[model samples]
Target: MKNNIWLDGLRSVRRMGETAVVAAKAGIKYAIEKPSNARLMRETFEDLGSTYIKLGQFIASTPSLFPREFVEEFQGCLDQTPKLPFSYIQEVLESEFAGRDLGDIFASIDEIPLASASIAQVHAATLVTGEDVVIKVQKPGVETILYTDLNVLHWSTKLLEKAVPKVKFASLADIVEEIKTRMVREVDFIEEAKNIDDFVNYLNITHNKAATAPKVYHQYSTRRILTMQRLHGVSLTDFEVVKKFTKDPSQVLITAMNTWFGSLMMCESFHADLHAGNLMLLDDGRVGFIDFGIVGQLNPEVWTASIAFMDALQKTDFPLMAENMLKMGMTDQKIDTKILAQDLERLFTGVLSADPQQILSSNPADLNDIMMDMVGVGERHGIRFPRDFALLFKQMLYFDRFMRILAPYTDIYADQRLQMIQTMDPNILLKH
Candidate 1:
């Protein structure tokens, strides 16, 4: 054990030294090229590999915490990692199921990966029992690399905070720790399997037949290997193809919103990452929720406060909204409720007054700016939102953008079919 620890320590030191050299080179290149700061940062993160790529994705998704330019620029941080050779994949699969023959588990497995991401690559396969599934195989040494990079990141954030005291307001080190926790869970396929199982149970209990998550095959799944039912469909992002799937695309948005909102109250953790890539319209017209890698949970108190906050926002009750926001956030400092309400009223009303069509046409930067402005006002008024709140808000923004393409000119807040506010109840919120 001591030898192993010593070897790991040596590896960590070597990795850190290599990372510093790469960072220095990138910095010098940025200085010479005089590229945009956002572009330079995005490229640097991408070059750093898996851990930093995942961090870039988090920044892209969480517009509430990040500046508009950085958030908008990181949107290009695609998760399509280069595919690993088939021989290496075979070695991983064989090692994972050491005593068994590949033929005993899968009748046929595709050589080409369906998709490749920073942590895993997915291949379509047929189970010996005649079920179609996807095999998500983890890349070799991902955990080691992740740990090394995250440790470096933690150290760097501390240095950054000391150098720029204003950056400390965002709690850079705390955010890095949070990311580390979530990313660690993400690499563990067992935890991801349980997440999918819980979400499936929630759907079953709610009788939500219109939406579904893939079923995990525990017999073949492990920490590094996740075998699950394969979903066949077109992504929600394929706007033109989605139109062919349903005449009223607006109904699709309504269905998705209702299902997701129900999950917030029913599931142990709600899906935190719901980019268009993660949502699909199946051939059977059911909405498919894929990728249970990252999820967010809310405590009962925060859940109650969040519901009240949403209710107030829908009703345009700024005072109640301010109260609920305070309840949902963390702050020991005393704040004047009336002043906070007035600030929220001015900020929200101006944003809401814009025509939906105009808002849809506006650049992502403009929308993110509006959200950042609200966050700025809240910060000044002693509102420090929990990470879960920011995650949920970012997801709502994603759904809003989907509405523009899937249900143009439709008011999500006012849509009766959405049942956004009316469905919240103590029973659902309190359910374990």
Candidate 2:
């Protein structure tokens, strides 16, 4: 759904207030120190209100757009919200169903939620038929609150655009619009059910055995109520537990990566929001991909080009890769081929040279430094990669960060993320 632009002025004032609060607290502390400050900021944001918490989450997913400290900080935003009481949950259901008795639909409901996010808290529940399921209930007044909060954000974006022309580069208004659309879709459980179905069907068609999604229940689902099968597993990011369950973490990682990669060809949209929290390790060691409310749609041309870009990036082919990106993303910009190639070459060579060993302890700051350089170059040259490319870059960076802790210095292109390609000897093909 499109964003309601009617509340533009109000939205601006609200966003300014939100930003002011964050700036006042964070700014003072940042001058003194920066350790775990982001974490503190996230806690404070959640404390302030739900809208800031939700905004923090959107920032977490779009790492390409934010500094690493903020992304890492906001990632914890979901876990900090105080859980709603059982009575509150009951009241929410009553309101949603117009005072209908919960006993009519649910035989039993667990008081403890499986996960409590900013907008909704998820609880494990069973219907009258004895089917185990998960229920995602919207927090009371979440829609109304979010609508008001989002209007403020939109207004703030508009004001920022007028106040500073540089804000246009960030696409503030469009970002607000996009965020509104995604958040609205998320509250629509029917859309999430479709996401589940699409992922399930994609897995079946690709013959992926190591990962699965929960079955979505349509009967009890509504705009605010999402009922899905209860999937049991440890999160994929839990290296210790995964080691206990499977002798090979590498094997499980391979299966998970392959399943995700195969989705590009078969799924309606790619799973755009895959953080560690959304992945699980089932009792049988298979991976569980949860929360499919947000996704990215890429044209086939861009998809093919993106795969080539990944392959090139893996091999550190900067010039050819830049050319491919232009082919996929830029059509009208008359890029001076030689200058673009040279600029890209310099940027990548520096990144590659920074960590030639791909060593276990290579500095991640080096990665950010290089990307920041690219961002600067784009600004200088009047070139900006589209949103999908930005999302893809963020995903790659997140994986890189994960690898730094899990398996430092090991080449990702050589190991966990490469099996989707069916080469008799993957090594030979990647050798190029």
lDDT of 2 by residue, 277-310 (tens): 6778899778899988778765667767877777
Give candidate 1's error at residue 369 in angstroms. Answer: 3.7
Local distance difference test scores for all models: 0.82, 0.70
Per the 3 Å backbone cut-off, how many clashing residue pairs does candidate 2 have? 8
In candidate 2, where is summed lDDT lowest over 10 consecutive residues?
423-432
Model 1 per-residue lDDT tens digits across residues 1-432: 697578677877877887898899788988799888888889989988888899998877666567767888987887789999878888889978989999999999999999999999999999999999999999876777889999888888888888898872367877788889999999999999999998898888777899998999999999999999999999987778999989988888788888888788677789987767788999999999999899999666776787687678768999998888878756778889899999989988977676555554323445555667777887788776676877777677667767866676787777778765435444554455
Native-structure RMSD, model 2: 7.1
The runs of at least 3 residues in candidate 1 whose Cα sits more than 4 Å from the true structure, single-residue gaps closed, are 1-14, 30-40, 63-73, 158-170, 315-320, 336-339, 353-367, 421-432
